[model samples]
Target chain A: MAGKRGGNLNWFYLLLTVVVLTGVGLMVYGQVGRGKTRAGKASMAPVNLAAMAEPDLIKAARGVNRGAESARVEVMVFSDYQCPACAYFATNIEPQIVKEFVETGKIRLIAQDFPLGGSHIYGFLAARAARCAEDQGKFWEYHHQLLALQNAWAYSRVPPVETFQSYAVDLGLDAAKFNGCLNSDAHADLVTANYQLGQQAGVTGTPTVFIDGRQSLGPNDWDVLKAEIERALGL
Target chain B: MTAAPADHAPGPPANRMGIALLALIGLMIAGYMAAYMLGLLGAIICGTGGCETVQQSPWAVFLGIPVPFLGVVGYGVMLGTALLGLQPRFLADRRIAAVLLAGAVAGFGFSAYLTWLEAAVIHAWCRWCLASAGIATLLLGCAIPEVKKLRRS
Candidate 1:
């Protein structure tokens, strides 16, 4: 009688074990499927128009503006407009930094191109567009447009050159000249040079802001940036 | 007669070890779940949404439900099973106790896989997740000796 009872208990335990394992396997399947769905959704989203409109003034072999630069301290911003973190900083942090410091002439902000080629294909082109806009004296206007429209081109499998051209036209730029500049490899060297300069300056990631040539490695809110600017300015 | 008596006498020790290990696993699970809940709440309150981003990521959901919620349920089940083993009638069944420990072992293995995913693929660490993994591992380790003894008996 005892032997029969033991056998019954064994069978019951085995059944429970199988049920638990099956539950775990089902969970793994669900997780993988969800990840694929998310990836597909991300791929279908529309390109960001605001990002293309933003000006990227920093180019290779470009000399620093020594005279019109009114700030006491020089703040170099090495950024890729396509970078999400850069967009976050632009939207959440840059405005306060500009208002409290840059506009007040306490810090002169210098923009540089550090396009991450593999992930953000249009990053360099976007940088070039901003530089071309700078030639037309509308750098900051274009800068705002690019960061604002960052997600516009995010999902595009192909680079959106025509979209950028439209932005140049809307900005009252000479379309013929701008289109030629966009297609020509003329500014490619400049973009490469700026990337190299950023790398040499110990910039490991996007939106790396250098205050008086000191690298700020991580995210810096208004107060932290202001304090660094003050220290750099000897104030 | 002497040999048969020795084999039967082995039942109490196996039962005691299984219960002790299950209780320890229960405590660990409770501690981790509390931490995760607190962290999730803190993230929501801060308005940064970094916590939400981490939570919403593919890693957050295992199967269909949130991983934290699963942890909560798994830990509760473990505690319940351990309490069941404490009853006089349940303690007499050595085979049943061993099977319960085996299920706990399986839980430990799954938790290990999740921990690997978090550290390597997700490239993020959640302290509560780590604690749960650690607790599950300890429970499995404790159950091993008891399981071996049961097999011998």
Candidate 2:
């Protein structure tokens, strides 16, 4: 009787193992397939253009401005350095926009900080770090560095102040001044001010953008952003 | 639940079964987190908490592999060892006891480190992660005496 029971248990074990392996394999394959399709199609999360209200720029604060002042289309961007979508925009799309629209004297780009608070532990500190770099007139360089190395420090088990300082040192900024600025909360108010600006504009997420201070766009894909810019330029 | 082989030092089969049960519980918790990491699950039902924040953090991955995946592997090994040790043929084998004990120790240490990270570094608590750590500690407790009995023989 014991022998017969063991024989039956062996079949059960083998069947269970096979089922578990097959289920896990299919789930992984499906996720990978969907990820590839999304990337290949360049499809982005949709935004409701009609629901986007014009943010009151007059009451909101702004950050560093890039491009020609005479540019007719002013693109105001609210972003968080620790946000993945915002990182994608900064790393992949923003440079292209700069080359085409900003350089061509068609648009002025303004960057505003919007740390998502509890969701991103390092977002506000990262914003302050960027502003500290701005003290040496290297805000854009530091901003790019932050997004590029986001994976390195964003989930760190320690406060990433030293890593932020290293970026400043690499950018040839005064290390002591940068460290002092970061540690002393020199730019904390500026970051807070920008956060308030985002809130007052009804911004609920990172990477939110407004064109000509009237039209809002969650520009996740370059094609969509470019088309919107071209339309704004009457192209 | 068969009787221990006569040559063995008579470690209770119940302890081995308990270890296996704890390991299975740990595996389920870790597997759920792994599913979330893989994007198969939309959101963790952590109830207005920091599960998303903690799981999305950099510490959630270790050397390019997701930490929860590592948890799944660790618990799976422990479960396998415990099940095999329970078999009549393997009851006398000290190697099975050693492997289960080693796995439990490793899991406990890793879970403790993650718990510390949540409290001190990430400043957020993931209930699933906390539960896994608790289970790992229990597994370690169950394995120690079994290994000791095996060693005495």
- Residue-level lDDT of model 2, residues A1-235, one tens digit each, is 1132122235434544665676577667866885675344322333333344334432344589999989998888888887765776788889998999998999999988988876477888999999999989999999999988888887777778999999999999999999988998787777887777666555666577777654344376677778887887899
Write down the C-alpha DockQ for each prediction: 0.03, 0.14
Candidate 2 residue A191 Cα shift, in angstroms, is 2.8
Task: Please tell me which predicted candidate would have the highest TM-score against the true structure.
Answer: 2
Question: What docking grade applies to model 1?
Answer: incorrect
Which pairs clash (backbone N, Cα, C closer than 3 Å) in model 2?
none
Per-residue C-alpha lDDT of model 1 across residues A2-31, encoded as one tens digit per residue: 142122234434544564566556546755
**Total clashes for model 2:** 0
Candidate 1 regions exceeding 4 Å error are: A1-60, A63-68, B1-153
In candidate 1, position B80 carries an lDDT of 60
